[model samples]
Target: MILVTGATGHLGAATIHFLLKKMPASQVAALVRDADKAAALTERGVTIRVGHYDDTASLDRAMQGVEKVLLIAGTDEENRVQQHKNVVDAAKKAGVPFIAYTSRTLKDRSTMANLLMEGHFQTEDYIIASGLTYALFRNVLYMDVIPQFVGASVFETGIHLPAGEGKVPFALRDEMGEAMANVLAADSSGSAIYNFTGSEGYSFADVAAVLTDLSGKRVKYTPAEPSVFETQLAGRGVPDVIVQRVIRFLTDIKNGQEDDVYPDLENLLGRKPASLREGLKGLYNLG
Candidate 1:
């Protein structure tokens, strides 16, 4: 059976949805923290196993009889490294032959450092050292967050962010899910890595233009200083850590870390991924 961790999450659930279309649900198992949340998946014939990254024994139990594992990166920035390490060690103990990890885009962070990227790099290193056959999927920022990044009422307030001319090659969450499913179904020999990114890149300014045309309202991209941006985010009730992370995201983009455009995502999906405007419309209901 193929075991996918974080099965209740947006990406994992979407991946399982596509995986079922290509293969039998009986061939798939989900490692989820909440059995209640996995009811839909279980009804579709998936074997739902309760597991948490903090619990190694539970992960071991979830890995039983599973040949392949998709270790979806955890979201807890503070504890993600150890959590990922737990999964890697459990997979090793379970003797799973192949493990696919969702990682971030490969880049040198000697200048602008990213805490998320740092965790991903550490997890990649651990997986490599574990000696399991693996596929490293280095994914870019999801276009699903475009609406949130720009803000909910962007058409009215315009776009405010610290990101300068930084461009991001954003892909749809479901499309990325499809790509991951395809990888899990394919051969897993001689470990490989794939960069799943959009065909085109877009900056905040481009997003503003798209919003203006789509909504028939005047929308503009208003750049803000890092301190001002963080203050505004915190004032809006965003957590201190999250606000700092958002600043780091914008800073990374400004440093040209997320600007690389690649065709691998389309190659994996056998079609072009959705554009930023298209993705935004779907997420924001821009009708």
Candidate 2:
């Protein structure tokens, strides 16, 4: 059976959604901390296994009789490395022959340094040293976050961020999940690295143009001072923690830290993922 961790989250849920298209739900399992949160998945015939990254016993229980595992990265940044190690360790102890991890995009850390990705790097290193066959998916920023980055009233308020001219290969989360499921279901013993990204890269200026075309409303792109942007988010009552995280991404973009473009996403999907114009239509609720 294939056990997908973090199964209730969007990415994990999407993976399960696509995996069920390829295989019976009897062969699928979900590792979740709360089974109640996974009622929908359970109702769909997916076996729900209660587990968390921090609890090795629970992880061991979740890994029982599982042949393969998709270890979705945890959100607890401060302790993620150790938590990831625990998952790997449990998978190893359970005699699971193969494992896959959801890692993030890596570039020379000139901006944000390793603050945002240290956990993933460390986890990758640990997984490689383990005896399991692995696939490390170095995923880029999700296109789903574009609406949040530009704000909800973007057509009226325009696009304001500290991203400057830096571009991101923002692939859709659902598409990435689909590609990952294809990988998991196709192979059981090989090892590989996949840099999941969109078909093309786009800067905020490009984003503004796409919005204009999709909505037929003139939207402007403005590079704001980082401090000013922080103040604006705060004034709008964004919590301090979330505000800081948002600023980190904007700063990373402003410094050209997330501008890498790659073809792995398209090659894996066997088709061009959605373009900026197409993705925005769905995001903006434009029929």
Candidate 3:
């Protein structure tokens, strides 16, 4: 059976949605912290196993008889390194033959030190050291988040942020999940690192152009100072922690850190992922 962690999350749920298209629900299991939240999945015949990254015994129990496990990246940012290690160790102890992890794309870890990238880097090392046949899905920024980044009043306020002209190869999160499900259902063990990104990259200027064409509004891209952007978000009542996190990524974008493109996602889906303009149309409700 194949087990998917973080089963209630968007990407994990979508992965199961697509996986069911290829195999029966009897061959599927879900690792969730609370079974109550997985009632919908349970109704669909998916076996729900209570587990947490902090609890090793729970992880071991959840991995029982599981041939492949998708270790969805945990959200406990402060404690995630050790938490991910716990899951990998438990999977190793349980003798699970194959493991797939959802990770992020980091262009350079040597020169630029980022807390987010550091956590993923450490987790990748432990997974490799565990000696299990593994597939690391290094995902990029999601097009789903573009709405959040630009805000609902983007047509009035324009695209205002500190991201500059740096481009991001943003893929749809659901599409990324679809690719993961395809790999998990493969005939052979998935044992390679894959970069899950869009076929092309786009800058904020490109985003503005897309919005203009789709919504009939002349949107503009404005590069602001990080401090100024922080003040603006603060004034808008965005939480401090959330604001800082957004700025961290915006700073990375301004530095051109996440500008690379890859073919792994398209290769897995056997089709071209949605383009930026097309994705924005759906995201902004223009269609």
Report every candidate's CA lDDT: 0.88, 0.89, 0.90
Off by over 4 Å in 3: none
Instruction: Show the lowest summed lDDT stretch of 10 residues, model 2.
Output: 106-115
Off by over 4 Å in 2: 110-114
**Model 1 agreement with the true structure over 136-248: per-residue lDDT tens digits:** 98989888888778877887899888998888898998999999999898776679888999998889999899888888899999888999998898888999988888898
126-169, model 3: which lDDT tens digit per residue?
Answer: 99988999999999989999988998899998998998898999
State candidate 2's TM-score: 0.95
Q: How high is the lDDT of residue 270 in model 3? A: 98
Which of the numbered candidates is closest to the native, going by highest lDDT? 3
TM-score winner, 2 or 3: 3
TM-scores for candidates 1 onward, in order: 0.96, 0.95, 0.96
lDDT per residue, candidate 2, 1-287, as tens digits?
99999999999999999999999999999999999999999999999999799999999999999999999999999899999999999999999989999998867544463376767888998999997999999999889999878878998989989888888888899999999999999955588999998878899999999889888899999998879998998998989888888887787777766778889889889999988877878978775
Whole-structure CA lDDT of model 3:
0.90
CA shift of 219, model 2, Å = 0.8
